[model samples]
Target: MKSLMPYLKARTVEELWEYHTKLMQSYGFDRLIYAYTCFQSAQSLTNPEDALILTNYPSEYIEAYIGHGLFRDAPMMKWASRNVGAISWRYMWDDPDNTPLGATRRELMALNKRFGITCGYTISFPMAIKRSAAGIGLVARAGMTQNDVDALWEDKGEELEIINQVAHLAITQLPATGQSRILTPRQSEVLELVADGKSVRDIALLLGRKVATVDKHLRGARESLGVETTAQAVRKASVLNQIFIVDPGTQLS
Candidate 1:
């Protein structure tokens, strides 16, 4: 792999994603889906809208996976959620007895098979925070079988893991500006103060606004972020890098 210093210094999430996708493609993984969320719960990712999803997967597949909320049924998603580090997709297919695969795996498997995405690998990055996680799925190129993926992985697995781990680290540091419009300036300000351990009255005092107005902003932020409370909004915004920024990221205006 080329020097990943450029990718580490990527100015925008889009730039990093583009570079990472191309990098993976060069190694024969033609499609990728990078997902991260701070709003993760014990069962689900909480909400698809809250996720930072960077993908080069087919639109039709993406539509079903995320748009139609089929990601909940995705076999790799299940694996990534439970474990860290890399795992081959061959395990699921090889296990005909379906000991590891779930009840919904059949449907998702059929969908993936239809799209020629039968072989791939999922790397679940380690997370320090209990409620946050990040992972990537590398779909093997068309006409590649599980055996082909196995051979490729055996040869280049170490380099691939290092590159992807670097990408994951770099990505988490960058602002997820794709959801920039999810909060207005006032809403973001309120959330930032909230994240700083400010109460409503304290935030109002700091922002030179009425407590009621601050509450309104907080409420708006929660609603916009699809969270039920201000604390949740703060956590979500902080995870997305929509709050507590020193140097703002790109395309956030």
Candidate 2:
């Protein structure tokens, strides 16, 4: 795998994608069939498999997986959804029941016929923000012996670690979308005045409430925005479009 140590510092998704592609290429397996699914409802599959990945795969392959519901049934997807680390199919054939060696494993044979994929390795990492898991699938043609798969995993474990790190970086880099946290009417009014630079005492007097009551509203606003400080609460409110901004100081009423 090409050195992704430098890309650990990359601030954008495109840079990370390029670094990952190069890493996969070094291993002679570059097609990354990555997908993200909610942990609570893997069956629901709100995000398309192709949507989460920065690198693109064959359109036919994408269509095939969705059309045939392959992601739902693939054992690797099941492994990835539950675990936080790397997994490969080198020993899957050793399973006594429904091993990949049998005719009942016709799904594997069908995949080989349709996609030119005979063997594959998998790595899955859980997403930090959402209760979901993200996985990267590396498939290759036959002749990759178990030793070869082990060697590749040993050689590329560091790269996979970096892949996980870069994924975390991308998640943090996402801009805060303009969505508002729901709040009570009084809470909204209290924060709105604070945004206009009004002090708590002044707000309390204007709203005909006790100072303690006004303070409670501000605290609730902070909790709602998931911030420690009032300024951060204000900024989050504005970012989520919960509160509209006024250049010249305006009242909530």
Candidate 3:
């Protein structure tokens, strides 16, 4: 088991991702899809900014998966959503009661087979906060069977779990660059003060602006984030890593 501490401490998201991918490949899992969501709900499953997805799968396969709405029915995704810890796809098929996949989901699984995404383990990490979840799907290299992959996991599953947990934590700390809409400096400042529980009047006083101007900025932030309330705007902005960032000599009270 490689020590992921150095990678976990990486200063940049790209560096962390690169090292993590290399570590997975060293374990014979050459393809990986890692996703995390701070807001997971029945209605918002398709909300683009709520979830962050990183993958090394082929572009065509990814296009088809998203284009056909296959993620909604992806068996491993379903398994990850409700459970924690690592489980092989074989386990899902063998123990349907615990990790059931309906007929359509089974078809989706088979469809993945055509793309050489047949055998792998799905690792769902324990969520530390409500409405939050993270998971990784480790796809075995071509020609590997379930038995072969299972054997590898049996030998290294515990270490893999530890590695992935750290990796997830590292990923969440990274700025979600381009994954969500960029808020203006004023919008970010307003949202940050709002998150600190400041009222519009307080924010106006703090920034030496009029109450109307403060209210306009807040409203603009809500609209830009496609959210209805200031609280929602603050949360969405935080999830997008668009707020609470310190710039030199920038003060917020």
Candidate 4:
């Protein structure tokens, strides 16, 4: 599989998603879905019953899934929420005690029969430091043999793992409330350094600027971000995910 290290430096969120979608297609899978719970704040107790789903599934299939609330009934949810590995629906649906989703289950089966799809492989990961989870599911069609699964397993395991990590970062940095704000490259840089506990002098030295200049940059960051102190600027930036707070110097390509 191709390395996704370059996407870690992606200048925008759209670029990240584009890179991820391309990576999924490279795995020889017919369909891919990435889903995450929505959050309101760091301290939010419940997720407000909303999620983001990115997939290549046809519009009708998506409509059917949502119309039936399959996300709530999907057997994959049971394993994904608790188990970290891939799960097979055939095994999950076969377990009688589990109470399979009746309508949705039939729909999925019919989908397979109609579209020649057969197996599914799902990988789940924790999204944030808080209570959210993220998952990606790859669907294999009827003609796909063991060799196909093996090929993907061998070639794309690391790629999927890296995608999981990137998804986590994206979720952690996602805004929790209100209208979001955009940050200029310089403002993002200064706030990120501040959040990492860098002093003005050190930031200036590293950025090859005078201390006074760095302080001015910080002031601009504070105003543009609509915060008061440098600490607040840092905190807001972290909350808004305008930049990577942990390693401020890391630049997105």
TM-scores, all candidates, are 0.89, 0.54, 0.85, 0.57
Better of 1 and 4 by TM-score: 1
Pairs with steric clashes in candidate 3: none
lDDT per residue (tens digit) for residues 39-154 in model 3: 88855354544677888889888876766777876767877888898988786455434555577677677778789887899999998778777899999988789899999889
Residues 137-242, candidate 2: write the lDDT tens digits.
7765356655676787787766766665565445334322222235666887888899999999999999999999999998998887667888867755653335
lDDT measured at residue 118 in model 4 versus the true structure, 0 to 100: 55
After TM-score superposition, the amount by which residue 185's alpha carbon in candidate 3 deviates from its true location, in angstroms, is 2.9
Error of 4 at 153 (Å): 1.8
Pairs that collide in candidate 1 are none
Best by lDDT: 1
> Which lDDT tens digits does candidate 4 get at residues 128-190?
445555677777755776556756667666666666566546644544223334567778887
The models' CA-based lDDT, in order, is: 0.81, 0.61, 0.80, 0.62
Q: Which tens-of-lDDT digit does each residue in 32-139 have in candidate 1?
A: 998998778896655788788888887888888788777886767877777899999977555433677665667677888898888889999999998787899998
Pitting candidate 1 against candidate 4, the one with the higher lDDT is 1
Query: What is the Å distance of residue 245 in model 3 from its true position?
Result: 2.8
lDDT of 2 at 10: 51
Q: What TM-score does structure 1 among the candidates reach?
A: 0.89
Please state the error at residue 180 of candidate 2 in Å: 20
